[model samples]
Target: MPELIAPEAHRHAAWLQAHREWGPGAHEDGFGLLHDDEVDSPDGFAAWVARLRSSSGPDRCTYRWIIEGEQVLGGIALRHSYSELVREAGHIGYGIRPSARRRGVATWALGRMLDEARAAGLARVLIVCAAENAASARTIECQGGVLEEIRATEFGPARRYWIDLDTR
Candidate 1:
């Protein structure tokens, strides 16, 4: 079964394999947290995760791996607050390994991320997807996301959503 766990060094090899499978910039749609150059080294990957874990501000963030024990299926990053730039970037961002897509991992990981948001005292979280990302839009909807607006950004048009966690 898939589960979300805090990022750790033991899963570096699995992350590397996943990144290689997706090639370059494939997962950047939602997962802009880990860059290829940064995670190419074990030490760098560790430092990257550490930096992500220690991040602060309106865009303060934390990330976790979607795993089944030793295998890393994907990841989710939750930003606690939003800066002007983050307003366009969204709050919860996620991605699944290429092999892991279309198997409910994104939905499952997103649900787990919502729980994290609730624990963090967030009443609601914003999620945005490229207008063309039907897969991501569906995943966001599955988690109770409501359409807020379609906004133009530097990247292109994005659909913004707000998911209320107060019910939980």
Candidate 2:
């Protein structure tokens, strides 16, 4: 495997554009983002770039993963800290390009993110996925996530899971 890296968000624009994925009503590429499409539009893309450059406080780290050289395989984001909103939705969310799904990218990317979270002083973390998304659930489980509950949310039905980095 190539090195797991953190590229400046500005340096990720073309990769982001080329790797976007649309999954059902949700764009898989947009999985962890609050407003993914906005970042893909003209003015929106510019604004997104500016946000990335100036991101601070709990927003300091965002990474674009590359494989075998320059191929932008996928990415992972680390919130320095999570608010109530994130505790319920999961601290990290990721998407492999459609072409990269099922080849263990998410598992690897997520495991890496968990390590980062642990290094940042998190002893345990919550990771939620849509209830119907078996693949996501499996990935979480594979990483030692304990299923805590399955419930309805404003965002629809979701499964709440927690992983203890201390044990992993």
Candidate 3:
């Protein structure tokens, strides 16, 4: 079974394997990876992990990795508060390694993150995915996500959804 874990330096090798699978880019959403984040070196990776660990405040994000045994499968993140950025990116962001897609990894991670959101006192959460991402839409819908609208973002057109926690 896959389990959610905090980002840690000890998992660097496994994490790198998964990262490489995603190819080169800042597109690994749930890891909280920034364009400038230096995750290729031990020191830089540790620093990045530390930054993720320190983001416990209400306005920050909490990140978790999906791991089954020693293999890192994917990541999920829950933003603790709403912001202009959240309006576009949503309160949660996630990505499953290509090898792990279609395995219910994202749905499981989203459900876990929803519990985290509820514990943090959010009554609802906004989740937006690429307008053409049908798999993500189905996953969100399975969790009771109601579509709001499709809007153009800096990245592209995205399907916005709101999941009411009270109904979950």
Worst lDDT run of 10 residues, candidate 1, spans 28-37
The local distance difference test score of each candidate is: 0.80, 0.68, 0.93
> Which parts of model 1 are misplaced by more than 4 Å?
26-37
lDDT of 1 by residue, 104-163 (tens): 989988988899889999998899898998999999999999999998988899999999
TM of each candidate vs. truth = 0.89, 0.77, 0.97
Q: State the local distance difference test value for candidate 2.
A: 0.68
Task: Report the number of clashing residue pairs per model.
Answer: 0, 0, 0
- C-alpha lDDT (0 to 100) for residue 141 of candidate 1: 95
Residues 53-155, model 3: lDDT tens digits: 9996656999999999999999999988888879889999999999999999999999999999999899999999999999999989888899999999888
Q: Compared with the true structure, what per-residue lDDT tens digits does model 2 show for residues 31-135?
A: 334444475555665566566545577545554354536566666666556776566667766667766678887888888888888988888888889999899
Clashes of 1: 0
The positional error of residue 77 in candidate 3, measured at the CA in angstroms, is 0.6
Which pairs clash inside model 3? none
* Residue 128 Cα positional deviation in candidate 2, in Å, after optimal superposition: 0.5
Worst 10 residues of 2 by lDDT: 23-32
Alpha-carbon runs more than 4 Å astray in model 3:
none
